[model samples]
Target: MNCLLTGSSGIVGSHIMFEWIYKALVEKTVNHLFVVIRNNKKPAKDRLLAILNDSSRPHFLNDFSMADCLSKITVIPSDLSNIKKQTLEKYNFSTVIHCAGSTSLQHTTDSKEKVQHQNFNVTKQLLTELPHNVKRFLYISTAYSFGIQKDKVTDTIANFKVQEFRNPYEKSKYESEKYVSETCAKKNIISQILRPSIICGRLIDAPFFETPKFDVFYAWAIFLNKYARKASSDFRIWIDQKSGLNIVPVDFVAKAVLHAFLQPNIKELNIVNPTQILHKNYVGDVLRYFKINAFNYVSERPENLNNFEQLYYKTIGVVFEKYISVPDLQFQSETILKFINQLNLSTNLGVHENFMKLIDFSVKKEFKSSYA
Candidate 1:
């Protein structure tokens, strides 16, 4: 089998590439892996070769088999937004995985126009230009595209009219997803979409450990800890103690996406927050696990009556005060759970220890470097 993967250098895309390589080695299903990357300044061929040949970086997440198997991969240069049908036809790909997108949540309305245009244009081009020999098209989308719907969240894609988005990233994703779904349906292309919620590092092993630290919430929490200690404040933030904070690990998301690819009659999958719990309670659990004391000041009215609060809220692209009060901010992941069970897979992908280790590792590194 042959496959083409975009966004091969990104956090999620890199992990997906490793996971697929691992699976290919184990199942002996794929022989050639074609990776398409954007060539802005550096040529795609040289950049990909450098990454594949690098021995210093931990590209396989402690799995040597994946790195070894990566030798069978081929790097291709193509602009996703304007990829030609002839270029894709040369690969004769049996499957195409689309994972490229601007994940910058802080992008303002004005800043997001270019990104949204690229995303939509690229997807449309891919759908129309894909070789007929390709068997499936898989899209990786964000669970946040569901917006702030607090009711029983279903697997169905969110209707833009129902929920209001705060940032361009979310708006663009929601729009792109709709376009992809419609185009796929019209063309009768076998397709699957995976929506993952806030993916954090492995949970609760240590503060300074060997793992990727990519969770914004965890990063913010660590930053808050430093600022709180330095300022001699109680580190209290007002929040609705009853709201739910949905989070999943990156490994789980990758595994779920791969499993969906192998399954039959699986059109759409959500890999995040299958089960929702109270946000304050969830955060409290994480904090308690780390032996951190956090004071929660529950208030009916919004707090932070200063310009700093306004600026901070705008910077994060989230109204922390309003987020705490969202009654139904949970992702439904029943499809992901069923798919995992069907595969008979049991691994430490979603364990809390991994996340904790990453957090500690980042914090200690910051402290030692005097960059905290």
Candidate 2:
């Protein structure tokens, strides 16, 4: 089987590539792996090699020589914003894994246009470019696309109009999901949409600084830690203290995607952890991790925050308020869980371990200085 994958340089896409290439190494089920990447300065092969050689990869690949694995793949360099269909006419692929999309939550004019083009427009264009022989189209989406609906998040497409989205990113994913489903149906294509919520880092040698487009959870944790350090008195960040966040690690997400890709029919799957991270525990753990006792989580916004605290929330918190203020929602995980069970895979759904790993990586990288 031949495959075409986009966003091979991204967080989730990198993980997917790692796993897919590993499978090829073992069983050789995939005949050819074509990676679609966008980099003007560096060649596509160099970018793929970089991801494979990164020290932060899953621990299982530490002993394997990446050179052998990297040689088995092909890379195509293109922005994909307005890719012509004729450009891909020569290659035949059985699967197309679409993982390229903007994850910025910023609300600026530039951000609005980026989210629209990257998420919605890109998917629309790719659907037209897909070969007629392609059997599977896997699209990576976020469970938050359900938006601010503090209710049950099922394994299905969300209604973009009825729900109130937290930001343009969520809104864009919702719109893109609609387009993907409609186009695939009309073309008689098999499409699977997988929604993973709040993706975190792996425990084994996870990268310190992720691409800014992704890694919102880590960014939030690091920002809060910085704010705590600069505050004179105890400070509280406003959030629904009781809300729960479904923070799943990348290894789990990658395995889930791999399993979903093999299945004959899976319309939609919520690739989320059954366990969730409560807001109080998250803040409490973060404070404890930093060895600081000056921070807390509060339901209401503090009135008299200091200059630094004011700036922190006004800049970081306000941009992420929609995510932090969200109430806990139930995620339907029957299909995904069944798939994992059938594969006999053990998944670590603990939030504390993953959170601490991220904190450690951030500290080692001195993200406080770099990001600040």
Candidate 3:
């Protein structure tokens, strides 16, 4: 079998690439692996090698030598946003793993709609315009794609009926799932959708608790870092101590994706942590880590706010209000559990310890990002 994968340089894609190339390629389960990298300044293979060679990367090649993996790999240089049939004609792949999409922070209708268009266009091109050898398609979507369901969110692939969405990302993914499902059905292709919750750092994996990006949970963590540092500011938060935040480490996500694409039994899988991080524990961890004294949780928004508090609401606070305050929605986990059982892996990878590791690493970096 031959496989084609996109987003080879992204957080989840990198993890999947680092450990599985040898097993898939050398073992002959997948005869060859085609990796897609958007080459701007240099060749795509050079760019992929640069990412693999970076010492600060959260993942590594391990016992799998870079040369051995590269031997059976073909680097396709083309952005999914502007896919051309001529670029992909020579390759024959039995599987297409579509992992690249817009995880943009832009919330406006234009921005969100633009993402939807780009995502849909890429999916359409991959299925119809790319080489006809693709017999299986795997889509990487977010668990939050179910929309803001206060009740239990199941792993079912039915359409989400909700009045509101937390953000445009959720909205886009929801639409993308529908499109992928319908298109794959028409094409007589086997499709598996993996909806991973908030993509996080490694826990039990070899390069323990490392991450390439600092967003989502880390975004608000950065907000609190700044909020607590202000001597005159009050550290008040609007949260229910018990509201659950669903997050899964990237390693497990990669593992789940690896397991899903190799077979055709799975239709939809919620790749989420078995146990979620509660607001009380998360707040306590942050407050204790920073030694913030005036810690207070409010059911309602504070009537009058200080300058910083106003700024907080105007910025990241407003962005993440749904997460810290929404009802705890339980993700269906039977499929994920089956995968974990088969792999002899544990979902509970010392939750608190891993959480603190993120806190420590981000704090050491002073919560920096080129995008943030």
As a TM-score, model 1 comes out at 0.79
Q: Please, what are the lDDT tens digits per residue for candidate 2 over residues 119-201?
A: 99989988987767776788999887787664566786543233677788888998888788888889888888989888766
Native-vs-model 3 lDDT? 0.73
Q: Which stretches of candidate 1 lie over 4 Å from their true place?
A: 40-42, 49-67, 158-162, 202-215, 222-236, 276-278, 282-295, 300-311, 317-325, 342-355, 365-372
lDDT score at residue 226, model 1, on the 0-100 scale:
49
Query: In candidate 2, which residue ranges exceed 4 Å CA deviation?
Result: 62-64, 158-162, 204-214, 340-348, 367-372
What CA root-mean-square deviation does each model show from the true structure?
Answer: 4.8, 3.3, 2.6
Whole-model lDDT, model 1? 0.61
Clashing pairs in 2: none
**TM-score ranking from best to worst?**
3, 2, 1
Each prediction's TM-score versus the true structure: 0.79, 0.89, 0.91
Best by TM-score: 3
Candidates 1 and 2, the one with greater TM-score = 2
Best by lDDT: 3
Candidate 3 displacement at residue 221 in angstroms: 2.6
Which clashing pairs does model 3 show? none
